[model samples]
Target: MDTRCNDITTRNKNEALCNACLIPIKENMRFYKCTYECNFVLHEWCTRLTTELKDYKIERDQLRHFSHRHPLTLVYLQQPNHNADDEDEEEKEKEKEEDFVEEDHHGGQCEMCNKEIWSFHLCYYYCKSCNYSLHKFCAELPMTQQNHPSHPSHILTLSNLVQSRNNFYFRSTDGTWKCSLCNLMWKNIYNYHCSICNFNMDIICATMSEQKINHPSHPHRLERMSGPIVSGCLACGNKHEGEFFQCTNCPTFRINLDCALLPTKLLIQNHTNGTYTHSHPLTLAYSYPHSEIISKYYPFCRVCDGKFYSHLWIYKCDKCRYYVHVDCATSKREPFMSIFLHESLGKTFKNYKEDEHPNLLHCPFPDEDDNLLKHHMSNQMEFISKQHDGEMLNHPSHQHPLIFFNEQTSVDKKMVSLHDPMKRIQLLCDGCVKPITTVPFYMCCQYVDEQCCFVLHEWCAKLPSQVQDYAGHPEHPLSLLPKIPGKFFGVFKCSICELQSNGFVYGCITCEFYVDINCAFIPKEITHDAHPDHLLLRVKPSTNLSKRYCKACQYSVRYSELVFHCPSCDFYIHVQCALLLPKLIKHKCDKHPLSLRYEPVENHISQYFCEICEDEFDPWEWFYHCTTCAQSMHAACGPLILQCEQATYAYDQQSVYRFLNVKFGGTLEIKGHSHRLAFVQGLERDGKCSECDTKLQYEMIFKCLECEFALDYKCASSFVS
Candidate 1:
């Protein structure tokens, strides 16, 4: 026999070789022959032997039945009887009927019995000789199972539980026996049992095969249990009780029988390499930077890119990288996963149109006729021309016929006017209405005479020399003063106008008054209510005893001696007072309560008032008031008051009276009364006034012929100046 492909080896020549048992074949023997080696053959029984049988050294004779303590033997063929009655048709019919009845009673072929039977019946197959049988399906089962390496003793067995105990059962607190696999409890009776181990499985667990099974909750097949029941169910975190599928090598790991068969890898929409960038992992049980611990741990699923609020998570990435919540990343469409473009790529360059370009010259070449350049030059030249024109008029007085002359020709005697040869000469400028200096004088041809020694600028002689109402002094008619002074001259003073004569001066010859060309046309009726007591008087300095301070503002007079003064009250004022315009005025003490009132009083204190907000008072106080209503105020309240009433008023007689009545504790004698009034010291015993509760320092004592009354300084000075 050839031993190369045979399980059993033998040395022989011309022997019909057994391929499996490796023995010489006999003429009447039953054996299996290999197609590749026609001479090779195997015994029929040897080919049917189980793989476990090979390890036991048993003799060929022992294969009959001694190992099983039974009379079982291998039979080659059964002997036949030849009798006429044995082939009876009726008897054969009866036998066939009996076989049919038996098959019907046993349902379909019993898997353990390995025989054909009827269908739709419940009965176990049994052997008549030894009473050993199995269900047809079980009879065909292999001796050992695959994928269940840990449990070697698993075997097929018939379930014989009572009808009441056959249902699914689980343990409960009601003192009942239960089946852990089916989750149903039984209260009354014992039923089917396991012969080995303390674990008593239900009919369901015993019959369930080790194969993938479908469950409604998961989208995968669930495998059967092969080892100890897991304590934690990976799907729900509850204590696992029933049979479950778990990998022993993975600590504390157990998946639902359903989850065990799911595809290991998933392709998620916004995840890469089974991880979501949106959900970076931190250390398990790690504290947050602010010392907060996440109570319910969850990880973002890469597959769905959504947060899975579960405690079991896989964290094996570097710490520096950021991870977004899977749900957040998915909703954002994973914009960070864009393909990077190289900087050198022309596609990255942006193109801009000429109109959109920020460069000054998009065309690169210079064009003299460019519209922008022409516009710029035109604007610049226009500005320069205006500046030059402004410079042409240095002084308003010189605007007539001014001419630049060299100093050499300035002292020419011919430039002197003949009308006033001995009179002091005064020069006039054609340009800015100002007097010309010792430069050469341009004379009018008509006025120039060598022997007459008279000369004047032609333009200066023709220019207008008189003006009507100028600024605030309007009543007086103004005329130009002659260039040469008359016989009586001590610095040419205009007696009526009260202004020093300079260059061409306007004068009211009827009043013997003169004013500079600028002040000649002052307006007579100023719109200011501050000076409403009397019309603003434009007059030069005079010996009038009443003209003291400026009537408008009460400021001391200096250069412009011709000022506005009120003849009625002997008040003088500056012209600028009439022009003051303030937005809002306030006082320090009563900011919100008081406002300026501008109205003329019959006996005005100091002249001038804020007319818009008609407030009148001593001009010494800063005057400002609202222009809406009638309210008088003091400038001292500006520090305290923020808002006030509208109207303004000029200083009234009451203010002047108040000022005069203020006492400095000095002795005062009434002009008409004969007796002298003296300030007497008050009692120093901290006695307060009955009326005002103020500590009185000095009391006034009035000594009269019939009566005497002691009064405070305030009361004593009230009746006197």
Candidate 2:
């Protein structure tokens, strides 16, 4: 061991000493031991400054030290731990006994905590004094090493060998690092550095064992890389060429270090024992796609408080399914049962007399007993039992006295009995069979079969009455009519909801405006495939009508008199097409359902791909996508296309150009015509034909040098064109 200081100092005395701990050294004339970089020298006495030879035991050629309880071995770099010559009979017998002891002591104290060890590792040790124990590898570490898995070529220096610095090489101003170990950047910290690549590893991360590590995400132990690098990270789905945890049993199972450390279970403070569980004080949950029981019961972890659809968990009760994190359970130091119980029962038992209450009659001691708290708790349990008898009083929604109905009852002549005196009455809605509690009941006069069902709330019975200007016919104010009209009807068409007027029809008194009650509330702005710029609007057909088609569902304008039109794009659709609500459109590309969004800004670039044609979308086009799953589809190619009976042609490219020109209300000249033809400015592209002065527009076009066949600006500028 070299004991030398590079700085100028005297040859003898305390001046020439180790920087860590200073001690006087004697001068040596002939013999000298100096640092490689300097000429300073020290005597042998100065080298070994401390006389602390803490006894350490060696097992299987590995030594366990007290200072740091990691496993270590004394071996020269030139000499390997095991010799090339195979072990003889005597050595083999000794090795077998060592292996047996290690295997049988699996349940022994953890070398670090001196507690019973349930998990295993590469090495172990026990401290006799403090009963504190740890692995030998965790004690003595090498000063430097090369070709480590994290860094293939750079040598990692130990903390004791390097001088400390206030600022870390990798951390930002706040001591955070962008290194893979932390995943996120920090402001300040000590870190290992690779000068060549400028890569820095934190001290804790640098010492991480290159072996199986216990993580909360997976049940099986995750091992260090013993095979080829994985193609992608399991958590973020990003391609990577780095160290990752892989399950030995499953080839496909892989996860990054950051994702593996995420907390498994959560205990919600607000939801604990509120709705999910009554017996347990805490509520627990986990992540999705783990265990079938978690998804089936929808158990929430009490630690994180997040609802868990799927993940492995240890719960309080097998019946209530109150799950919690195993680590959280172990670290829980304080009792929460008392606080939770007091909060739940404090208000209900505020006035109950301890002496007179029969539920409190079974108290284990006299009224003045010292264990009054325990007796009070016993009485609270009795109150809870009585409250669980499936009885409720004066629920806010109910008007008359109501009782829990044993069976569905008929509405014919059943009078309320005064002796039972119903505390509440729950009437079922006529439209949706869900029960509605109230006093005054509206009975429907008409019967469906022999059952004269006549009990419902006033709002439920009159729900079919309200209506307004429906469909594209503004002249007709649609209202629910008692009977269907016989005038000018082949098949009754609804003015509100575009569906056939099969049920109760809402008809206009002045004109032939009629629609179903459901159709009256059809929203105006809706997503459509035909016009990309804006949602289609329901309107009466214009007198100057060119051929038009439904932007959504891609159907022909069968009912030409009335249609859904987009003024911005000059797009039109039949009234029936406009009646289709935006929510109904479903795209196959996404697993979750999609919804329609109405965007007013036309400048926003369309960044989605179409599910139907598998093509990029023009920003100006109106579209629909599953909000949750992100599956997108052209409004024209919505799922309702199958229901359309008529045959439809592919969307006309020329019509799009015409619509654009009409919107701009501009004119331009085209080439190869005797007179300059009036054309609207459409989609435009660069490069004029050499033969013609006309600028190129569409991808494919006819060119003539003599005639100069240039496209009009409107025709070339249109996105669809």
Candidate 3:
């Protein structure tokens, strides 16, 4: 056997193989050749490694690895002494096994292959600064190589730099490199790269010394096959011509190079499901178990809400059951998003709980202080079961005292018993005019015809008397009112949404600026799915109406309306469009949910048409599509097109207020009107408004159900607002 040479760092400039590490020794690489006629070559760095020798005494206990910023410390456990008694030796062996289990629990994943450093051999390199770890064999990898097999023309240097990319290199959203050889994205690890040629090979791909690989996605070892194979990849469920790997045991189970090298674990941040954002680590699932499949519906991707093919792989949280598409796991806009949101939002919402009801911030009787309130209530109104009947309140909204009920038992015994027991009646909240389905609510004690006259949700009942720091109207505090305070018609135009509402309003008495209940909870800044790169600012309608069209529906956003605008990107979305147009939804036409697409599908030259209406539509605008079925539809044609339907209130039999899906000639029943109003587009021949006396040309109006009491949408705000 030849002894390894030391103190020999000169470049060999020879095309040969490193006999120690088995990597190619290309031109300009440092290597040693045998002085004898026998051809034997070794890399200069190979001199420091103990070649295939177990239990060899290491000269250095620590090594500085390029993958990590800190020095890596070697953890080694020695064999127990055999001189002990048999019983003692058995006990020591058991203790050693327990220690190994403990080490496995505390161990970190190796940065190179994303596998746990099991310490089975009781030897591994670990960084104390960060939990980055590496196997002993992985530590001997060459830092740089000239004329690598992946890119033989130029030298490949080991780097973790994501920004060093040439024009040919398309950088992924998550700041990871798409390895040139494997075509899989990787991050936070060293990769051999040539910036000049835009070539990159991840550490795992660079170290492949065998044609066979044991992939976590399969139980069998897979052998690489050179091809333009027509078979589909089981990981992504996409069929394309590509070099693939086939299972040695099962030929049918094949994975393309891209899917075979996918990262086993992925950590995503600022990923959104509707308006909710989450940052959780997702584990790559080989496949969804058969038990999890429901009614032939596979797991839905939380980001897009579309059901991906069941056979395809996905990244999911076992606990949350939160599934994400394999391709949608990363975001190229995340780095730009943080900086934009910080500068745009200006204030952090960390203090405010995103899931909490807005009215909970000003709850007069909080759950935490229930006992204390009960103590003080000793001299006050009588109390019932804490779980069911609650303390009574002399609410200002009703003349009679209101009794609180938290559970179905109390509602049944106290209120339901008064009505027909066999009949099922839906209770509508008097505050927001919405159905009171669940929870703590207050019902009027004084009954009219054996029925409670009033009802309010516990949160709705505790609405703050005044919003002192409302983001919409900073000039003055908005006072909560049953209706728009000064309007004789009991309706007011919501300054935020530019819609009319007669329900609850938070209004500025001085400025006459009012926001409906739904609009009142709108955050000052929001991170919408449409514009993930920046936070959308809540901007008061600009006076300039020429460019006030919404990017979503392409409808005109009137100057009097408020919109969520991205000043940096010139993106403006209607408040209703932003809140109501969900990222994913199930339509009647398709069994699977459709995902919203921001732009036209690339390279699709065919004319775009709605799957529902079967009418041609603009492809450049936002639309919903199902990738599995290749179906597309317009937003207006979808079922959730009633985006502006905020609430429904029934004042009486003849007078009801609700958002109607009114078109050019539709009809609706309003709060103040006794009969339904007919929707009509105002014509040049249209007469003046009954109230405002303004000409009704170039506008939408609701004509009186009985007579020519024509009212424009602006004047209609009085009755509906």
- lDDT by residue for model 2 (60-167), tens: 554544233344443221211332258887786465434332111232443322233323343444444455554333333343446767886766532221222332
lDDT for 16 (candidate 1):
61
lDDT of 2: 0.39
- Candidate 3 residues 8-87, lDDT tens each? 33556555655444466887777676553324456665544433333333357877653455677887634344455555
Candidate order by TM-score, decreasing, is 3, 2, 1
- Clashing pairs for model 3 are 173-331, 173-332, 492-721, 500-721, 501-720, 501-721, 502-721
Q: Count the backbone clashes (under 3 Å) in each candidate.
A: 101, 67, 7
Query: What digit string (tens of lDDT, one per residue) describes model 1 on residues 530-555?
Result: 43323445455545434255432334
Runs of candidate 2 with Cα error greater than 4 angstroms are 1-13, 16-138, 143-232, 235-253, 268-467, 471-475, 486-504, 508-721
Q: Give the TM-score of candidate 2.
A: 0.32
Off by over 4 Å in 1: 1-254, 257-310, 319-721
- Find the 10 residues in a row with the least total lDDT in model 2: 654-663
TM-scores of all predicted structures: 0.17, 0.32, 0.34
